[model samples]
Target chain A: MFTGLCAFPLTPFKDEQFDPVAFARIINNLTDAKVDAICAMGSTGLYPYLNNDERRTVAENAVALADGIPVMAGIGALRTRDVLHNADIVQRAGVNAVLLAPMSYHHLHDEEVYALYEKVTANLSVPLCVYENPNATNFTFSDELYQAISRLPNVAAVKIPGMPFGDKVQGEQRLARLRELVPDSLSIGVSADKFGVAGMRAGCDAWHSVLAGLFPKTVQCLIQAVRDGQGESAAMASDRLSPIWQLFVQSKGGLRVMATAADILGVCEGNCLPHPLKPLTGPARQELEAQLTSLQLD
Target chain B: MFTGLCAFPLTPFKDEQFDPVAFARIINNLTDAKVDAICAMGSTGLYPYLNNDERRTVAENAVALADGIPVMAGIGALRTRDVLHNADIVQRAGVNAVLLAPMSYHHLHDEEVYALYEKVTANLSVPLCVYENPNATNFTFSDELYQAISRLPNVAAVKIPGMPFGDKVQGEQRLARLRELVPDSLSIGVSADKFGVAGMRAGCDAWHSVLAGLFPKTVQCLIQAVRDGQGESAAMASDRLSPIWQLFVQSKGGLRVMATAADILGVCEGNCLPHPLKPLTGPARQELEAQLTSLQLD
Candidate 1:
């Protein structure tokens, strides 16, 4: 089962090309920070925007740069065939596990969605995680779907969106409810910056994080605090990073805010292509800088 | 404004490779049958299942073999950037126009959906058709969405699923409503095998078809009858093809039953990957063959 903090790094581009060197630097830092697993080509990484070759470059480079850290590559596409093909490429690239999102161009029914995972895993011999990001996929997995998917081969974990933004009861209670539904062998991870500590407290095996990619110190501290059941330090870390989490919520993690944060902390260059959200600039940059200084990112 | 019988062609495969020769044969036959515009890489072509290179091959081969006929290539993906990239490739491949389905992996709001078209068209110099396959996208185009999208540059047409399977009143009233809302320049089409004559009778500007991909003679005849308001002949054509249409309805166009019809009619080998629906096997093929013989596909 996949566990601990999984860092999802941004795919930084340079000179209108996928800069493998720039991406490598970010992977090295995440590894240096002792992140358990590095997740590449996630929603945060803007997987859909990158071309096929760029995606391959990002995955291969991430694996090579990571110093023994298991790399979990996002391998979701509109078709099951493409996802399967992506899994094969990433596996060949030496990723430890693939985070598979059941992405679709159509409103897929439960059976069709389940069959997608089945067909994909039929070709997959490596470890896989079911990426249940409802915000991205528009379809939430029922406990039944989760149970069926868990029975699929090599399903090491299931990463659900942390807190399911805007739901009234938006904390550990939701994660706890999820834990009760899945099998004991199937690991669960949460995918929101705000809910990292709360997620660990709620029995999540890992924190599949976007913010942790940039500011690993706080995330690692938060993960430790929750593991020790020290609510105060967990609260402290969450409070310290509240501003960035707010930015993520507001911007939908599209802009290169996380990349900018990494750049500010001397991790990697903060550049992205096909900018889906407003990049941190002017006032936003100043605010992020002030927050980073206060936190002392190193 | 692409009008009349727009024959969408099947992407045939041989030795698990996209058979350009087989695909070209189907395209030639459609042109011979006098289809106005031959739309390649349509849903009938089993598009999403194909890889990036495979998709490129299908579009390019369709254009090269179309014999001077206007080709409308389907260009839809999980991201706006990818769509723009695909539009460039298909345009470079020499397609006249692109049929774009605003396919999303996420639940996109109206503004986000509108912005997708804006961003895509900003990169495109070619004509674009909005393929609002609600069943596929999960988001229906409201009159507000339609008006906003219509104002975007180069949006020439909109294709909505006709009969909206299982809606109590499965008729042309919705098409009339769509027509009343859209601008005069924006052509409206329906995507249902059963709705062709009725859609034309109900004043659909075009027929975005699946059956036309194979049996062009019947489709062209249906189109002409509808144009001349020959409801009786239209009914006869619809009646003649009802068994096949029934199968399409049952399968939701996943089985490539149309491709099977192409095979039955000796157009091209009817084979598809990642079959979304049940294939024409056992009793289904026998039933289809009897129906095809009655229509006399020669």
Candidate 2:
């Protein structure tokens, strides 16, 4: 009975240090929005940037903030050992589930991909959500591979990044096929909150939202509209949310954008994306400000 | 002065675990061949499959085995954090240098690529080698990016896969230009031990060998012939080694093939490549055996 929006919390950093206080405030804000589940240390949460200890701390804090709502921990890496290590940390922290990307440098055949899921499921005590973020992983699970993995024990759901901006039709077709393949008990989650209404109309079970981390009420309203078959209201909310998504996506890197948005919303004091990603460009910030105003989000 | 042959030790695994004893023995065998230096845990060592602790152990054992000879640790990953973590571990283990690959993701612009090297170099205490293994990384460092990274304080060298295998003249020309752009102190290392004599003739400072992990003596002999300016002897040695190289290349996945050959050489007890690479086929074994016999490597 998972309804409403799921928040993918941004991990806060101050002067290259993990800011638990700032992170706590961000998670507390998401809880105030009443997000159904909190997804911690995912791509949006900058999972890859954090060390094992940092990841454990973030997972524990996120679970505490949710106050009994499920906290799905993202625990995938190029190496299986590292993934296992992360899973152990999350499981010990008592998270609800593990979200994993089947990512590796080696070209994975279908059997290899299946084996990865089988191995992870065998080791993990918590329910697992197989994340199908092909852009990050560089490998897409075949429909056949997905079907096999979904049948594995403790695999509670599938997280699909529903159609990016242009590939709506293909994305919709994939979602439909996935829905038919997965059993009725297993949920199908969409990270494309902007298209949550369209994806829900196409048969998605859950809306996993990055935007919900910032604007929980608006996203919850949009989700409620979709659940209640109020397509017009849902579409209107999505239109208002589109500008914010565009602003974040244009800010060089996803983590930086997420942290900046968190800062702007007053959820966190300052944004600190680790090294390599520079601070926002002048034009990019101006564009972000204009978009926020246009959507009446400021 | 590093030149001629560079041996990458077989990362020994016992009971499906990283065995420092077996690794030390393999390193000892290479040292006996008077190999220039050991590139520990590079691609040939199955870098992607090893965990941080395993990587650290391998580096420490490599240093101990080298016994005053240089040990260059391979530190490459899709995530910048993992790469930095591995670099710090290797540096602490007292390896002479670090070898790095570009970030493993698609559509990475030149600036992003440059930033990766810059960040890694800033933290690394030892010398660094910029690895350009396009076959593995999928992303090739441009001459412009390579030139910029080569100028960093700790960047001592650049490793490029030897002469374009597919007769891509443009690639060869680019390599030639890259050689010109890199500082003279920054040595250019080449892979492809079979035609390494040719690579030496083409102006590379040293030949990086995966096959050397299997037959260090044969590889050392070939490199010595090349260094001594005995072209005919070097060509003869290459001809003798060609069959083994073909077998190594033909054994299923490229890295797996090398690992399997390492198994046969008793360098590592059986091949245990992580998910995605299956064991070698029956025909591959037959081919490997015949090639080993023909090369009189038995």
DockQ of each: 0.20, 0.30
The interface RMSD value for candidate 2 stands at 3.8
Residues A1-298, candidate 2: write the lDDT tens digits.
2445677877777766778888888777777766788889877777766678888888888877777778998898765667888899988888988888876565555666787788889998988888887666666778788888989999988888766423557667877777788777888887756567666666677887776666667677777787788967777778777766665555433555566666666666655655544445467766665666676641
Q: Whole-model Cα lDDT per candidate?
A: 0.73, 0.73
Expressed as tens digits, the lDDT of each residue in B120-218 for candidate 1 is 877777888888776666667778888788878888888877764223245556765666777788888767767777777677778877787777787
Q: Kindly give the stretch of ten consecutive residues in candidate 1 chain A with the minimal lDDT sum.
A: A270-279
**Off by more than 4 A, model 2:** A1-4, A163-169, A192-198, A228-253, A277-279, B46-53, B76-88, B102-116, B119-125, B133-142, B161-165, B191-202, B216-253, B273-278, B281-298
Each model's number of backbone clashes?
1, 0
Error of 2 at A31 (Å): 1.4
Relative to the true structure, candidate 2 reaches a TM of 0.84
Tell me the tens digit of each residue's lDDT in model 1 across A16-102: 567777677777778889888888888777676566787788888988888888888888876665677788888888888888887
TM-scores, each model vs. reference: 0.75, 0.84
Residue pairs in steric clash, candidate 2?
none
Which residue pairs come into collision in candidate 1? A106-B136
